[model samples]
Each structure stands twice: as structure tokens, then as C-alpha cells.
Target chain A: MGKNNVEQMILNIPSDLKYLGAVDAAIQDLAREFSFSPDAINDVSTALVEACSNAIEHGNHFAKDKRVVVTLRFNGGDFVATVQDEGRGFDFAKALRDEAGPDPMSERGRGILIMRAFTDDLKFKCDDKGLTVELTKLRGGGGDAGQ
Target chain B: MKITQREVGSAAILDLNGKLTGGPDADAFRDVFKSLLEQNKKHIIVNLEKVSWINSTGLGILIHNYNTVRGAGGDMVVMHASERIESILYVTKLNLLFKSFNSEDEAVRSFTAAR
Candidate 1:
């Protein structure tokens, strides 16, 4: 695929966890269209789901009136997804700087770590409107298919 | 998610199907653990062979249930986790905390073998 052949898809949903399946489906389809390896597709799908979950839970606080917007962009072999939530975001830098990380037994606080692990690149931007987390993964970057 | 409970020897196995992500699924899973504890069934095995998807929230639910079971002097282990689910567990290092198995026989035998 050529870089010029860019495809973009957008999804806007309420801050409900129920809609996560739709996001996963969309990412899977787009990754397949880009000819991403199965492992890469799974990586993208998993990372994006974590991003959206954070947007819905932490950013939007699951407020009924709040909304989460997801934008997927495919360019050549790169798949990029941005999750935006209408709420004040947390300190991404501070969270990452905590070398001790979260308690091994803790139930929460692993979402960000999972998102960072499965994606090639993860970026965050907080503005007056809300916080947007951008995740990027490259086709064939999933390494060994067996894993 | 759907959870079906059955007893094999002294272990109570929860066969889970569908996504374990948070929401109603989390509540249902919690309730199942609660019921198990009330029944004095402490040894638990979570069979994830049919579960298609799991996110951080789902992991949270599992951790919460694991802690609850452990606190009740019980134990929880998982079996048949997909590569995707395993990836999440590995990333979060929960793999170290939760013992995993590849087969039902091995998982079921673990409870007996532990003693």
C-alpha cells in the first residue's frame, strides 16, 4: 500500500464500556485491510481497546453526557488510532516516571502499561476540550507470529 | 460474559465464555465468586478457553476476584488463556501472580497436587 492511499474512519460513542466491541471490530477490519500480520492485528486491537477504556473510564469518568471519539487512520503499513475523551486528563509523564510502577497485585493502573507495550508508538495530548491518546503500530512489526 | 460452574474433585471450575471486560460482566463474575465463597468452595479454576476478549478492566476484575478468593483462604488459577489474553497478563506481570495451565486435566490436578 502506498502512503498516499490513506484511509480514515471515525467512531463517536457514549462513555460506556459496552461499545468497546465495536471499536475492536473496526480496528481488526482496518488492520486486516492493511495486510497486517495476525499478531500485529491483535496488538493493535488490544492497544486501542485499552486506550478507549481509559478514555471512557478515567477521562470521561463514564459520565452519561460525556462522549469518547475514536479516529482510525491507515497509511501504507502504519495503523494509527486516536481516542479522545471529554474530560481533564491525568499526568501521563508522572505516571510513566514512577519507576516502581503499580503494585504487582493491583487490579487497576495497568491499562497504560498494556497500551504502551502493544503499540509501536503512544502519544498523549491534553487540551481544554479533553485528552486524546494516539497509538500507532506498523504492519509486520508484531514479530514472531507464533507468539 | 457467561460463567458456568462445575466441580471436579475439590476444585470449582468456572468455564467462562464471551468477553470478560468490565460492566455487567464484572458484576456477574464478582457474584459468582461471592456465591462460591458462601458455599465454602475456595479452590477455584478459571477456564478461559472460550473467552474471546479481555481488557485491563477485565484483568482488574480477575485480580479483584483472585484477591477475594485468597483472602478467604482459597486460591484461583486460570487455564486456556488465548495468546491475546496471555499478552495482557504477561505485560501486567499478573502472569507471575496467577498460575496458568494449558489443559483442563493439568489445571484440575493442580488443586489436588498443591496439597
Candidate 2:
């Protein structure tokens, strides 16, 4: 039998930034039910929301017909999430720290940095598939080593 | 988050709860602060007793209002901050930029006292 700790869920939304609020609520509900710390839960929620925002804006180019897929996992002691887009893959390094590094006043381009700050690990995967933001965090902070 | 506005004598009190991040309140929050400033509201007190968390965007909006309020010769006071947000303020050195109090009454009273 499974340890009852490894559970996963998937959600697909209609590629709109406005859907972020709903995503936040869903993350919160799952996190709270799993007894996650408020900070950890908020961190994941914020980072995931930013990833979806970036996907809609940069990945799919905000195309009305596009769709974004988000996969959430609660495995062992870690809470992992991924956001995938249908557009051509993106440059992870550039997104992490832009060429100009982004000004504080600018609303755009800081999503990836914010995601990195909130999560223990944030990666952009490429291998002919697409741009995927892979985010991982210990629900409490054993770094996944304890997992 | 739950936001409530009430008039206290001449100033308005905005009571906030939960987290202050994105969604419906982000723009409205900034607009409310701006509208208050436009009304020549030089004194503002934000009740943060119940706020759970805030992201950089939320912090940015607060700073946006802070600069606007300061530029107009008005001061913003915060009250009853949780340790999480207080840590962020301290780390960002925003704790020095604004005055904070332990309770709602204390924060509002300081505004009246300063006037």
C-alpha cells in the first residue's frame, strides 16, 4: 500500500491571468488540509501563480485559444508543482535574471525571480517539449533530502 | 482578504484581513490609497492585525502608496503586524520608513495625536 503521503492532482485552465485567483484558492485549500505552514503554503501559491502568469504572457503569448496545464504533487514531505505551456521553449537563465535585471517599478519580468526566491528549486526544462517551470519545496524544509 | 472602510472623525480606517496579494483587491487597494490621498488625507492608519501574508507585489503597492502619501506630506501608520510581514519589513528596511503600533486604537490615536 502507498504511504498515503504521495498524492497528485492536475488542473487545466483557459490561459487567462484572471484565473490566478482561483488557482490561489485551490492551492491554499490543499496546503491547509495537508497541515502546511502558512508561509510555505503562501510561498508555493505565489510562485505557482507567477509561473502561470508568465506562461500565459510569454509561453502562449496570451492567445485566447491556448490552455495552460498545472500539475501539483504532494509527495513524501515535499510539495512540488509544474506549469507547462504550449509555446516554444523559453530561456531559463534569462527569465531568472533578465538582461537588464528588471526595474523594481516594472510589473513584468520579475515573475521568475520571485518564484526562485519562494521555492527551493525552480528550473526551466527544455528538450524539444516546451517551457516548463519545475518548482520544488519541502513542505516544511528538509530540502527533499528527508524525502 | 477582507477589507472594511469606516470613517473615524476625519480619517478613514481600512481594516484588512487574510493575505494582500493579487486578485480583485490589488488594483482596488492601490486606487483606494490614491483616492484617499487625492482627498487630502494626510493621515492614514492601516490595521494589519489579521493579515496572513503578502508578496512582493503587495509590498510594491504599499510602497507605491507610501511614496504618494509622503510626497503629499501625509504619513501612513501600520498596526498589529504579524511576525511574517514584520520580518519582511525589517529585511527590506521598510520598518524604518513607517511607524508601527501594537494595536488598532494605538495606531489611529497616533494619527490624531500627530494632528
Candidate 3:
């Protein structure tokens, strides 16, 4: 189906971990509506968490006043979700580069990698306002991730 | 995520359930691990059989705890990881960093075996 023939949902939550449950609940509902495979649903769930975590922890810097916006669209066959933050964006590319050599002892720097692994298509955008991370996965695109 | 603790011989087994995504959930996991370190209970095995999933934040928590225990002359490993969680570890290359076992008994045995 065409991207225009899509149903969209927008949710905005404060940049707080306590609000994560609301976001995840909506995701579960969307997955069921989209008839996503169990595995696909799990992947989307994990990826969504990572995106929101990065937005709150890195993009918004845990600023309670800031908000994270999540947009979900189902184009009949594919589901796309976008996470938007209200703080200045960092160089995601640079972060990916730094995380290239996984350090067993390192305690951080794997958020983006995990996001990329569970989604079929992942994109990052930044502007003066903040950053946006988009994640997409097909209904059957449930197995063999990590890019 | 909910984390419960138990002891098997000299090893500490942390039973995890639900999603290990960070936020308040992550804080709980971190607190438990920190307390274990404080108690000098370092030979740890995180049992993930009931853990439905884990994100990057969860992986970070695991790594952080692993290093902490190792630094204290102890060790940490994972057991009963779901297929999806195992895939995450492989993609992130954490599989190379931490020892993984198919069962809690196997993981517990590794610590003594290493000694």
C-alpha cells in the first residue's frame, strides 16, 4: 500500500522514565492491530524502548520539562514509528563510529546499535530544535536483524 | 523489569523477568547489582529465562555490573537468555565479553570451573 494510505497516531509524553509504560502500552496495541508476528512485535517493542530511552537520556538530557513525541503510522503492510526529542541533537554517526569496536568493559554506547539491529529501516535526523529517530519494520520482517 | 536474587553455592543468581529496558526498570536492576557488589557477592549469574526482551540500556547495565564484579575479583555471566536477547548480545558483540550458558547450573559451574 502507498504511504499516504496509512493510519497515524501521535503521542507526546514528558521526558521521564515513569512515562515509559504508556508508550510501550500503545506500541503493544499497535502491534496487535497491525497483525505483526510475535517476533516482529518483540523487535518493535525493543527498538521503541531504545529510541525513547535515547531521546530522554541523551537528546533531552532527562529534562523533566522537555517532551518526547512519538508518531506511529501503519501503511497497511509496514509500520513506522518516529521518536522526537526537544533538545539539541548529537552526531549519531560519530557515536556509531565510536561504538564500532565493542568494548566488553564499556558500560555505554550501544543504544543506536540495538536500535538498528531490531528494525528493518532506521533513520536519524537533527535540527536546531532537536533530534528525530524513525524506525520501520514489515509485518513479516521479524527474524535476522542487526546491521 | 523485576529482578530477584538467590544464592546457589557461592554464586549469586539474579532472576530477571519482563523487559530489561532502562528507565525505572534499569534503575532497579542497577540497584540490585550494586547491592550485591557491596555485599561482596560477585560470582553472579543473571538468569534471563523469563526476561522477554532487553534493549541497549539493559545491555549497558549488564556490562556495568560485570565490570564491577570483575574489578572486585569476582565474575558475572548470563544464563537462559531468550533467543531474541541472545541475538542482541551477538549483534552488540557482548557475547564475546560475557560468558553465556544454556542453564543456570552450567553458568554456576563455570565460575568454579574457572577457579
lDDT of 2 by residue, A1-147 (tens): 132478888989877666777778888888777777877776677678778877776788778888888998888757889988888976677666553335543333445556765678888886555678898877656221110
What lDDT, from 0 to 1, does candidate 3 have? Answer: 0.82
RMSD of 1: 2.0
Residue-level lDDT of model 3, residues A1-147, one tens digit each, is 244368888989888766666777888778777777767877887788789988988889889899999998888668899999987888877775664745667778788777877888788899877899999888767534643
RMSD of 2: 5.0
Writing each residue's lDDT as its tens digit, candidate 2 over B1-115 gives 7778776765577789877665456787878888887788767877788886665556666767777777788878788887656755554446766788887677767776887
TM-score, prediction 2: 0.69
- What TM-score does chain A reach in every model? 0.91, 0.84, 0.88
User: What tens-digit string does per-residue lDDT give for candidate 1 at A1-147?
Assistant: 455488899999999988998999998987887778788888999999889988898888889999999999998768889999998988998876763548978888887788878887888999999999998887645522233
Q: Candidate 3's residue-wise lDDT over B1-115, tens digit each?
A: 7788999998999998777767677678778878988998889999999987676777888887777788889999999988778878887888888899997788988989998
Best by TM-score: 1
Q: Return the top candidate by DockQ.
A: 1
What is model 3's C-alpha RMSD? 3.0
Once fitted onto the true fold, the runs of candidate 1 whose alpha carbons sit more than 4 angstroms away are A1-4, A140-147
